[model samples]
Target: MFSEKDFIAGQFNTIETASFEWSAPSNIALVKYWGKKENQIPANPSISFTLNNCKTITKLEVAKKSDVSSFSFDLLFEGKPKEDFKPKIQKFFERIEKYCPFLKEYHFKIDTQNTFPHSSGIASSASGMAALAMNIMSLEKALNPAMTEEYFFAKASFLARLGSGSACRSIKGQVVVWGKHAEIDNSSDLFGVEFSDIHPSFKNFQDTILLVDKGEKQVSSTVGHDLMHNHPYSERRFAQAHENLSQMKGVLSKGNVDEFIKIVESEALTLHAMMMTSMPYFILMKPNTLEIINRLWKFRTETHIPVCFTLDAGANVHVLYPENVKEKVLQFIQDELVDYCQKGHYICDQIGDGAKQLN
Candidate 1:
């Protein structure tokens, strides 16, 4: 168990200037986490597959400042100054400054870019915030060289969660659990934990994301999470998530692909269902989203491919399947599903180890 004091940095060795770079991947939830409590804590535990190919790479350069009165930073996206993104970064700094006391003592230059489209519903905030957190931890590790490897990643995930709840899951790869569960040892509400035990069948899992609609979502995930506060079915939904997570553990351990498909697809639909039943009642899925899903269902039924779908908080559909069926699944996606995508746009990715340090 960790508390706020565990993360507070002590006196640091004097450093004039330093730079660090890291790349963090986005994750797709199998058991979705919808609501939250105070301080970005998840209302229910969730598990996800860390993704490859679609990620955010961030480089942080810091110079010591004479005045430590306020946090100062400049943001760049894809090598271009991005003023619009400053407010979010500023909020993140404010949230994490208490944990990382050196924030106000340095002027930071944050240069970031994404492998996937910026806001194409690929959880850019997750990857972006996660990458930034890893870079910050690198700087901290330099200041305090005695920091252990375990504490380093755990604190990094802790900081990432303040920026975006799901970003915590992006810190570790293949499988990660984000909320505290009785069955999952060492799980916490503060930071995500890597799930090491798994059936070999889950290794190298494939995820082909179909871009049905690239536009920004009608209702942001933040607001959607807020709605759960007063939702009539919120308690039941939270309980269901816990049960689903337990079942998922068994499914993954036993290599039950058919059961995996059922749980994954149901969780995706349940996520959207929560949105539609909210007070304002909004739908993020486009017509093409439904078309692609029906086609996927038909393909899976006729071919018995064990392919399934999961969703983030957007209209994009993530097609999930085992690696052994990669060729057949890709062929099916191209033949029947590509037309439903936006301009036939899709990204082929697989499960990957979490974040990596560039320098």
Candidate 2:
């Protein structure tokens, strides 16, 4: 929960329609967070780089109602009505209404669109929920103008986490740390914080997405996270993630590309490995996924380009490399790995500035 410093008593404006818009970027975790507890708390801490091009923009228009006891909202995606999203949005509002009593006093019109496809292994939920949380906090700020800008983001992260755990990390820029860690102070299970003390070389990191599969997943991330509850290796995976985060923190700060590549790739494979070993196993990686990994390994070994691969919960790959070696890496990607991708397509994005409010 946020402290008094986060927000003061609200004074709602009489304006019939108050509009807000915010854009938030998706992130790829370097230290993977695969499992969680109830209330969206991660089993282990994770760190990620906020992406540049892949994002979600959301516009919310609020019309105050005479009664303050009922919540009403309509949602649209890419300007088309998305009736399926209403239940999730309703649950989100219900979860956050305790912290924000004014929620029930308004009828909301939300227009959200993603720069990328849904369920494309890009973590669209992270950016989407973060942007929605940002828009809500924007209105909260209007009601209580005394809140600090830092607290504004903190509150947004807090709210977003209630919707999606990874969404909390999307609220911060460059790099972000979610879940509490002993090495970092002020970290919380409730919100993510910007992990800023890194060497300049790391700030310009690159992630080229290899779209191996564009179709919907056989198992949703929600199901994957749920599977971890009864997973035989769940405890060991949690401890392993903690240990990996400790090692990678030093590697990230020192800009050790070699160690960074190893740790990140390991974490990615370990994440999928956990899924495969679950009670009722499921394989998220395709045969092409393995082919791309082999190609990446061969190319890196022959050329010494320091290229590496990481997978989300889907079949696609996120090729991680330093900015200096981007040209060589991209050339290799085109000549060799792109054939494995769906439609030979990919998205080039880097660590980016965090969520921004347009209005």
Candidate 3:
């Protein structure tokens, strides 16, 4: 088990200036994590497929400074100064300061950009925080040259989780598991771990994001997660997540696409159901969201295409299917589902191998 003491850095090598850049992909949870505890600890275990095209690229420029009292940083998004983003970054720095102690010793300039539209329900936090965490870890590695590759990634994931719970899964590979489960090896609530024993049939799975609504959600994820605290069915939902994860593990290993579809779709609906049944009873899904889902169901039923849909705390629909049926499913989407999207816009993505440092 890793503790706060383990991640604290020792004496660092002297450095005048350093710059690092990274791109991290967003992920879609197969077993959704709805609630949280203190310090971003998840109420239930979750698994996700790291996405390819939808990502955030972040560049960090760090210079040593004499004043170590507080963190100093300038922030930019897509080449424009974004004052509203500073508070979130400031909070993230505060949360991770103990783990990465060198934060206060440097003045940072962060320039970030996202491949997909921000606040459009694509989980910019996951990719953005993961990219920023990777850049921070790069500086840490520069200070401590002896750090191993495994430790670097594990600690990066740990730091990312401090920023956003789902961000931890964006740090590594085609499949990642966050939060501890009895069956998964090396799984921990502290950081996400890669799941590498997946069957070939699940490899390169396609994910087409249908933009049901392109505007910001009415309720933020933090508020939605908090509602679970007083939710009547929170306990049952957490338990169901565990059982579904176990079943998913078997389905992934055995290459059962049919069972995979069932579990994935059920988990997505259960996530929203929790929101609808909460105290405030808010719904994130739009009319087009349901239309797209129903059309997907009809298409899948008639064609037996094995395609499925999942939601990510928003009105957008993630249409998932195997590589084998890409042509048919994509055709069905273009012919039927594109009209439901905002401005006929959608992104075609696939399972990816997590984040990577840029040259």
Cα error, candidate 1, residue 108 (Å): 0.3
- Model 1 poorest 10 in a row by lDDT: 116-125
172-226, model 2: which lDDT tens digit per residue?
7798999888886677888998888788778788999999999889998889999
The CA lDDT of each predicted structure is 0.93, 0.88, 0.93
lDDT of 3: 0.93
What lDDT is obtained when candidate 2 is compared to the true structure?
0.88
Per-prediction TM-score to the true structure, in the order listed: 0.99, 0.96, 0.98
Residue lDDT tens for model 3, 112-160:
9999889566779999999999999999999999998988999999999
Q: Model 2 reaches what TM-score against the true structure?
A: 0.96
Task: Tell me the number of clashing residue pairs for each predicted model.
Answer: 0, 0, 0
Instruction: Flag regions of model 2 displaced more than 4 Å.
Output: 1-15, 119-121
What C-alpha root-mean-square deviation, in Å, does candidate 3 show against the real structure? 0.9
Error of 1 at 256 (Å): 0.9
- In candidate 2, where is summed lDDT lowest over 10 consecutive residues? 1-10
Candidate 1: lDDT over CA atoms?
0.93
